[model samples]
Target: MAKKVLLRVYGMTCDDCVAHVKNGLEKIGKNVDVSLDGNAVLDIDNDFDPYKIPSLDVFNGRYKAQVKEIKDD
Candidate 1:
């Protein structure tokens, strides 16, 4: 089973920011959903540590990502 992760992302102010976050997160998980309202959700493998998600530096350090919640899905 996969785990659902809710991330509180900061600095996402536009659609382009959402796209950048979604693309960056998709590299590490599945079903990536990013919003301009400062949130992201994805499905990751159970064995992976949700807290260890790397900083989303793909967009030139404009965004900060933190794990807000994690649960079974």
Candidate 2:
């Protein structure tokens, strides 16, 4: 099984921010999808818990990511 981690991010205002978040999350999950509207969805192994992940501050700390919801899929 795979788990979808929906993150409600903040301080992301452009395409660069989206890229930053995606790159950072890619290290933690197998697949990462980021939206410019302050949201990110990560597809990780079911054994991994999104809540245990650390805060994301990509692009020289210009933005921060927060986990908003977790779902099993």
Top model number, lDDT: 1
Per-residue lDDT for 1-73 in model 2, tens only? 3888888777788898788778888877866889999878888887777776545436347776677888888
Deviating ranges (above 4 Å) for candidate 2: 54-60
Give the residue spans of candidate 1 off by over 4 A.
54-56
- Assess every candidate by TM-score: 0.86, 0.78
RMSD of each: 1.8, 2.3
| Alpha-carbon lDDT of model 1 | 0.83
lDDT of 1 by residue, 1-73 (tens): 4899999888888898888889888877899898888888999998988887755455458778888999998
